[model samples]
Target: MRSRIIFFVALIAILVGGYGIYDSVLKNKDKSSVVVNEIAPQPKKDSVEYITVWRTLNNIDRGESIANDALKREQMLLTDALDEGLRSDVELDFSPSTLFNRDLPQGALILPEYITRENDPGYIDLLVTEGMTLYPLVVSNKNLISDFIRPGERIDILTVSSPSSNLSGAIEKPIRFKGVTATLFLQNIKVLNMGGEDSEQKLKPVAGKSEDGFTTIIIEIPPTEVARLALAQRTMHLEVYRSREYEEPVYADVRNVMSNYIGIEEMRGSKNKNGREGEL
Candidate 1:
């Protein structure tokens, strides 16, 4: 009986020691797993690849030449910049001969599809940019228009009108005066087509004067100014002034026209009253 009890005790002690060793091993394994998880770096959810590309610094109009300072380099996400015709080069140079084919908003990515070359077919027709209107005007003053006028040149429009009384048959005011007035109608108007053909294709180069005895020019102007231009053309004679440099916008200034009117009045007054053909 003693031997059997000793045997049972020894068996119980062996089972307890084995169980303790297994528990310690399990605890150690759990600790190692937690340490590994804490040390491993986690990936960021917002991580992405980016590339540097060219973007417009300001809103660029169609058919406008790209200036060197007009473009800026910016970093954009790769997914956002992955267009087939996208201009991806950070060091790419814009050519002076190329022009924007469509209007681009500020910060727009430059692309090959957005540009047109000067030698392209129907280039003159493409000079009218978006939000602009083309107007055809008949001009008879050859002395004002130069022979070198061509598309892409800027010109100013003016009107000459004979003075009429503002009073509609009312009692004439004491200081009432009638004279001629020359007014500036429009400024910085762009020429698109001249003489029914591209200026480059003309053989004789007779601009502003042709066999028809009048010149028809197609010009580009703002949409809002179309009605004003039409009214000016219908009311009085229109003339063009080509300047070597652009001038600031100045609406009808009657002072300059009045000076000419005074000169004419002085000449008429200097003549003998009996020799005067009619009333002044």
Candidate 2:
């Protein structure tokens, strides 16, 4: 009986010791996991504060290379402002070590051609580093009219009555002239006429319409030909002829027309010679 009792006590003690060891190992493992989590660094926020560099002049046509210079200037300005003890609620970031080598701002400013001259509050938006300086916006007179003229469009000419001309003659009838005929020429070749009518009788006449009493004829010309036409208009009295067929003004390819005149042998000697020339 004594032996049996001693054996039972030993068994119970071994089981209890085993259970304690297991519980201690589990607690240690949980503590180790928490320590690892605390040591790991957290990720930073992806967003940064942006500032505007205002008052830049319009029509600043510095090419793409200007981006680098603009960035350097922005950084220097920001650093100077910070040194002056200027404080704001915003958190400023203009670190050179960051992306872009601290050269430029995260945003850009697009300047206009002309600004209002009458002390009008004109401003441009620029992506600038913290503490950047802004200069007054400047503009050119040519840029003011850039939007008015464009590629493949009629010229926007602003004409005013001559002071020497009789005011009564100019204003009397308001010259209700409509459907005036005009001749259109491209490279001195008359391509089409303005009015739909074919005969001269149907074409109405306007008195004092032009200096010689002939109606002024306006023609749509390409940008390259604008200077040529301007000179021509000043020297020549433009006349309008009516046509039976109301044909749309068509532009011809001068190159193709010239090419047709070249003989087969001459075309073959040229750089773009194709074997199929004059084959048809």
Summarize candidate 2's per-residue lDDT along 1-280 as a digit string, tens digits.
9999999999999999999999999999999999988866779877544333332222232211122333322322444445544322222232211122112233433222222211123211112223332211111222123132111122222222222232122323223122112234332222111122332421233222223322223233345655654553443223222223335653332234446534533544434345443321
Q: lDDT (CA) for every model shown?
A: 0.66, 0.33
Please give each candidate's TM-score: 0.44, 0.19
Report how far residue 233 has shifted in candidate 2, in Å: 43
Off by over 4 Å in 1: 1-61, 65-99, 102-126, 141-143, 164-177, 198-212, 243-278
lDDT of 1: 0.66
Mind giving the per-residue lDDT tens digits that candidate 1 earns over 11-110?
A: 9999999999999999999999999889667777987777777789999987787677998877877777775344354554365546787889998878
Which residue pairs in candidate 1 collide? none
Q: In every candidate, how many clashes are there?
A: 0, 2
Error of 1 at 57 (Å): 15
Question: Candidate 2 lDDT (Cα, whole model)?
Answer: 0.33
